[model samples]
Target: MTTRARNVISAAIVAGLLLPAAPALAQSDEQQRIRKLEAEVSALQRRVFPGGDGRYFEPEIGGTSQGTTVTAGTPSTTALTDILARLDAMEASLQTLTGQVEVNANTLQGLTTRMAALEQSGAAPTLASAPTPTPTPAASSPSQASTTTANNLTAMTGGASSQPARPAPAASGPSSQRLAAVQAIAKPKTDDAGDDEYSYGFRLWDAGYYPEAQQQLTLFVEQYPDHWRATYGRNLLGRAYLDDGKAREAAPWFLNNYQADRNAARSPDSLLYLAESMIALRDTDRACIALAEFGETYPAVAAGRLQSQYEANRAKVTCTN
Candidate 1:
């Protein structure tokens, strides 16, 4: 009931009010510290893994005393698995391609071997017994001269005879005349050696012995210039060079075959080979022109192998419509 008792009672009331406010202030400060720690963790996560949703810290589960642990995201796991699968698939594809390349190489080698064998066994023509002899002026009468001339013309225009003629022995004017007279009287002899030589050359060509084949064919042409097989020999020589991958060298021989004997059986064949040579030389325009000439000149015989060859070459050269 005195002045000191009243002051003590006022101080107690003020202390009661201040105690509740102090607990609220402490709780607010704790919340601010937690927020600041979360901001620092988020900034570190961004710097460590910029483009990925990598592992990051989460707020403690129960309380601030609990330890922070990393948890993986579903997207990151899925991305890693996908990358491994893609690498495996790429390895499998590369292995498959390598196997296919080896198989193709082996197949090509087998084809080449088989083709050479076939060519070697199938190229020679059957041999004949003998060539007819030229007529002698003294033995035949005037009326027979025309007939003899006609026969000579027929033999010249004819395709290759199965039997080639033997070369006459070297002689001067009178001796040559006597030898011719005797030959006209005597029966013609078959040149079996010449036929064998021709067959050997053709077999060489077929067996891919190109250099040897060229030499043999050239010798045959030179030694037996008037033989029935002369035209074929020239054409085959050109083919040997062409098949040997000497297109530029082959062109001249093919051209010579056609120019020297246009009416010969293999003349058209020579033209076709010439076109092929031109294509090998990358002269498409010239190849096309040569093909046109072949078509114009040999319309009668253009339905079989020659026609097929022309069509294939035309496509290869990509000729205009």
Candidate 2:
């Protein structure tokens, strides 16, 4: 054969072989793409429906007219829309929760601020004076007599009596002498000085030296907070203020003593006194609440010496049943 003729025939044979291979390569590429798409869809299905009972797209929407042939790279638009809607709903819910948290934080902040003010001032603001209610003289317990006298004194002082801002009745010679003796008595030097210190304050209170008793008991409680007598001292401190005609200033101390330990030795007494202070402040509602709490919390104690005191105070106000 001639060279040009042989070259032409060789080129034709090569063309035939290459053309067949081109179709085979195209078919293989298409199969690889389909397999990749199927793998991606399987992963998405596993993630969206881990239990495998549910799939992202409905079976009716599969890309087959005659059989269950699923088309590669095709997803249900409605499923995508539902997922987006769910995401939007979750965002809205998160925003609502965040707003509630902020509101709670603000409320907590307000409470903290009020507590700080109460601590700094050592009392709440004095309320306006109202007509002081008097307890009838039916129950003549010694405790009741003493408390009635105190109420009369408070009403007189708060209404129009020419008392100083703080009462200092220790000016009389007998009171002065008693106070001097009390001052001379040294605090007991022992691991437990609580008893002696509390007794000293009690003596001052009994002797009508309320200011001195307040100072002494305040120091005692601060020094011996864990001591058994601290409860007594704290309650007595409030009583000193109450007897001094400063019921508003005394109420917080009484409340603190009762709330510090409701089962403590003097906690029941403190609750009674807290109610008394409330009555003096003309807050009959809170006074009744304090009285109710006392009766409920210490039923046994309320039936004892406190019965007369409770009845006397209960007579002072009309509480709702």
Best by TM-score: 2
TM-score, every prediction: 0.43, 0.44
Candidate 1 deviant stretches above 4 angstroms: 1-190
Q: Which pairs, if any, clash in model 2?
A: none
Predictions in order: lDDT: 0.63, 0.67
**Lowest summed lDDT window (length 10), candidate 2:** 122-131
Q: Write candidate 1's Cα lDDT for 1-321 as tens digits.
A: 989999999999999989999988997887778767766766765675465344333323223435433333334566567668989999999999999999999999997776544333323343353543432223123332344432332232123332322223235444566446433432223556565556666766766767667877778887776776667778888888889897866776776676565666677787778888889989876777667666766675455446667677777887663
> Candidate 1: which pairs clash?
none
